[model samples]
Target: MKNVAVVVQDGAEPFGLGSICEVWAEPYHPDDDNPVFEFVVCTAEPGRIEGGSGFDLFVEHGLEALETADLVCIVPKLDFRHNDPRAVAAVRQAADRGAIVSAHCTGAWVLGDAGLLDGRECTTHWRHADELAATFPKARVNPDVLYMFDGNILTGAGAAGGIDASLHLMRRTFGARAAATTARRMVVPPHRDGGQAQFVRTPMGQTEADTLAPLLAWVSERLDEPMPVERLAAEAHMSPRTFARRFRDETGTTPLQWLTGQRLALAEELLENSSLSVEQIASRVGFGNAATLRHHFAASRGTTPQAYRKTFTCLEEQSA
Candidate 1:
């Protein structure tokens, strides 16, 4: 929220650490009005830290830096399988006290080392998910998601997933506007649902003629309209069966699943930024009715539309 401590150890992956810094350590810009964190790069043993690459870094702060941090972030390191006891203890202590503790990629190992992953749903890079599961049998490892939160602990998948995770935190803490501002400055998507898959089975189509992006964009604009598989396939100029197969191959989710997620996301934005009634929002997002919207909200967000609106509407109001 305010103070962020990114824990880096020897053999740290530069990109993971850099992503954390980019998200939390950005300087204030008058035009952006985003939260400016007191970000510190700390280590268990502050001094020369070897990077995963050939480069090196001279870190100044030690574990003490985490004592007052609102967020404790564990950066991925090459030596993930082996966690330093001092670092593990610090992270555990931070989480025990209710600070938001997050790890990116193989950084989940440190949380595992601290016994924080036990009985909690978590994820790492797909390549290391099985290893993480094998190493910590008690942890419920879900390798498919880009990122997930089990209480105060957040785990992100791989390298680029760090941006998704960090921006998500920004959105949760500050509001969607602040997160979008930060993301705009960083040149990244404002939000990618944590439930999104880490990888699709096939490479995304590149050309405008080949890609489904245009169709997706078209659907996003007309979410309130009925879009059965037949309708969508007709719009895409393909058979329903082929369209469904291509959709799964490209998006890693079924068309219905994708539609539900998009509708929910649109509903959230409307809840925060618009003065629409719940029924209106439900209709606009294609949930059909307030009851349907509430049903999906309960199943997906674990909170009712009124409660979510109250929470984020206040944030938006305060920001305004």
Candidate 2:
């Protein structure tokens, strides 16, 4: 987590490369406690590399920088169908030596070329999902998800999905609070569940007035209250059936699913920022009981509440 290297090859997408730098190489933080990664931009071939944007970038570091990187990030390249063998080898060697290797968008093709995607769950932009699956049959390519974290390797979809994936790595390595701080600085949500679907078929010509934004904000504030769809629909001044349909159309998820995500996010905030007991936190977040909270928390986050607290508890408070 301390050392991070972003691998850029010729025709690299600028935004994908910038996303890694935004999350890992940002110089200042409002909290002053964020992890400072020793960030380096490295390439297989040093000197001027052409970018997808019809510009060139001067990459000073070669593959040697990846040897000590705790995490190696692969930015999407325009010509991902073919990768330089030297770059592929460096990526494979880094992963083989236990460094976390992540790919953004078509960069998964690089992992596939390196044979790192074999037997691993992964994802990429929906446009390229079929090709990725066809090329790397052993890789379980989930087209619906924004990102996938299987073992030490992570794969993100396109564009903003890279930010989501990188922030997730920050959360896992640092803590929820740190991740939240970083997201706040970037003005984005800290943790978007990786299971969230990448595409939403919004109704054409949808006006801002028809949005469920107000209702969503209302529900988030009242997470501790009873929130059956009937009640929620009433609050939105719509019939239950219409509300359900509109919820899916607007949010790309069911009402209950969105509520659960919000509750889980609240639970995570409490877990990081407060001294509330598990039972108290569960009640506060409307889970009603510790057992129920534990079940959902483990299922969604891959860790129990107690374990999460142990790993992410504020160090100063613990020392005090």
Candidate 3:
């Protein structure tokens, strides 16, 4: 994960490109001790690349810049439906050679254009998710997630979800500490538990007073305690049925499902940083027992808690 190449082209989204650069293009600082990346912003052609935001960028590298990259990122563009054949081929080839390839927002279109999304579970900005699904029928488009990774291909939802995906890669390749350090530097949350569904617009027109954020924060602190929908509804001062409806509207998942996800996230952090026994962690995270924790852990992560801890600890040690 040391070498990274970001593929951009004409009509590039400035914020998307800048987000990728912010994460991977940092110079080594003695204080941070984070691994530096050999980051190159390449295009299919070297020279003036027109931006979607009425500006132009001059790029020096061609598709060849991807040859030795450990990670290849596709930056979103306004005209995402059309992509250069050469750039698409380069991205496909990069994935073929075992490099992790990621697409941010509408950049999933490039992976789709290259036939890389076939039979893969992927996502993009919710606005374009339907179009992407329609265009690539073979791709299983999950429009609700902030980010998803199927094998070597990573796809992020819209906007700040790019930061979530980037930090996730860092966490997986390095460790929780490294990811947290990077996130602190960027002033973003190291891990965001919910999906992009929370950000999608709705006809109901939700306001700050209607937000469930405060209740979520309160629940997050008490994950160790049992929380059924009725209890949660009472805490929110809503009936169980009304609470269920609003919970899905705001979080894109049911209360139990969302709680499971939160518990899994907390379990991961404990697995990475704590020396507690698995049973202790399970109890702390509201799973009650190690068996229940292992079941959900295997379902969500495709690995057991013990194996996950071992892998994270090994990566952390290697990075250190």
**How many collisions per candidate?**
0, 0, 0
Model 1 lDDT vs. the true structure?
Answer: 0.86
Task: Please provide TM-scores, in order, for all candidate models, with all chains considered together.
Answer: 0.63, 0.63, 0.65
Q: What is candidate 3's lDDT per residue for 1-320, written digit by digit as tens?
A: 78999999899999999888888898987778888999999998899999999899999999998999999999999888999999999999999999999997999999998889999999999898899999999999998788999999999989888888999999999999888988989998898755765444332112232478888878888999999999999999999999999999988879898888888888888887888899999999999999999998877765678877776665655476
Task: Give per-residue CA lDDT, model 2, range 161-221, as digits (tens).
Answer: 8998988888888898888988988888887543423142222222232478787777777
In model 3, where do residues sit more than 4 Å from their true spots? 205-320
**Deviation of model 2 at 252, angstroms:** 25
Candidate 3 or 2, higher TM-score: 3
- Model 1, 200-290: lDDT tens per residue? 2212222232468899888888999998999999999999999999998888889998889888888888887898999999999999999
Span of ten consecutive residues with least summed lDDT in model 2: 198-207
Error in Å for residue 144 of model 1: 1.0
Candidate 1 vs candidate 3: which has greater lDDT? 3
Q: Tell me how far the alpha carbon of residue 27 in candidate 1 is from the true structure, in angstroms, after superposition.
A: 0.8
lDDT of 3 at 67: 96
